[model samples]
Target: MSLLGDDSTESVAETVQETREVVQEEAPPKTGSTSFKLARLLFGGVLAFMAVDNFRNLEETVGYAESKGAPMAETTVPAITGSLLFGGLGIALWKLPRLAAGAVATFFVGITPVMHDFWTIDDEEQKQQQMIHFLKNLALLGGALAFLRVGEDD
Candidate 1:
């Protein structure tokens, strides 16, 4: 059965051709966006900067992750931060957008709740600070999710 029409004998090639034509006809022309490009650059820059900062203080970051009860903190911290560095740069350069978005989204999802569990904090000030970090991660996750949609229209 062909998805392009009711014809049961339609070949895959024909269906693909028809679908391609339809998509080509329906897709809108792409628009240039200086603002979007700038945003990508900034978003990527921040991630890269944070990764570098964490690397510069690798022992401190590892210790902090250990304090948070993270297993294999010694190995995990550098890997995660390294991913952030590459993901950020990839996104900023638009070199590997889908991979970059995945990398970023993965980082946020993996670390945010673990690192910023405000519900687990008893001190009011610390809880507030963790909550702020949690919220910031949520926003960054949203941005990464948006980046995942970049090539969808194509």
Candidate 2:
């Protein structure tokens, strides 16, 4: 009765194929390469775990930050660590990836030098440790910057 092809097996199969093509066209591109995804997962998980560790040792963390001349160490440390917590989760889960990257980038930018001022340290052993921490933060920052390119509106 219809002008279009009948609801025969072939017609149904053709319709399915057309629908699949449309879906393929409309679907979002892949988020990241497999290697990058795995890296992101580990990076985010480590940041989150670090935040938890910081919180678990809040007093010691606050004291350390205070020793580094961090203003409002008690409040600032917790607030900054929160960015790590949520940002890490978002980065790992691919939720709000841009904002999450921003949060992570903020941490590395804001705290890396202040907390691990290797150049300012006189003690070789302490300076070496701090330098390692600083470089680690820089590497993590590089990863966060890469994640900023991820196609995500949230």
Candidate 3:
């Protein structure tokens, strides 16, 4: 009976140790350059495209900004477009990513509330549309934060 008890305790300890080892072995490594590049493209591509689209339809974008009660729609629109273009390219190219992330994150923070103010909308369809855009921008903000933290030893 003593022999059986001793063997069982040892077996349990061994099993625990093996489990730990397996978990450690299976842990994912840090993101490699290839994976990081792909992530960068995914995160930055949308902003770049948006910037280009805004440039192409500058007048329409300015009008939308004006409808949202943005001051100086003409000047603000061009400035926003420039920031988006530069920030998106910087992020995608891994050039000053922290700053680029901050820019992109800032863009989302400033635009989401103003552009997608569901609380101020009367129509149900518009409210729903604004809510969706608001949520989507928040998710993008989270992604930008992650991108900012990437490469930090933390």
Candidate maximizing lDDT = 2
Q: What TM-score, computed on C-alpha atoms, does each candidate reach?
A: 0.80, 0.77, 0.76
User: Which candidate number maximizes TM-score?
Assistant: 1
True-structure RMSD for candidate 1: 6.1
Clashes per model (N, Cα, C within 3 A): 0, 1, 0
| Backbone steric clashes in candidate 2, count | 1
In candidate 1, what residue range of length 10 has the lowest lDDT sum? 27-36
Stretches > 4 Å off in candidate 3: 1-31, 151-154
lDDT of each: 0.87, 0.88, 0.83
The deviation in Å at residue 135 for candidate 2 is: 0.6
What is every candidate's alpha-carbon RMSD to the true fold? 6.1, 11.2, 5.3
lDDT of 2: 0.88
Model 3 over residues 123-154: C-alpha lDDT tens digits?
99999999999999899889888877762421
Clashing pairs in 2: 96-154
- Give the local distance difference test score of model 1: 0.87
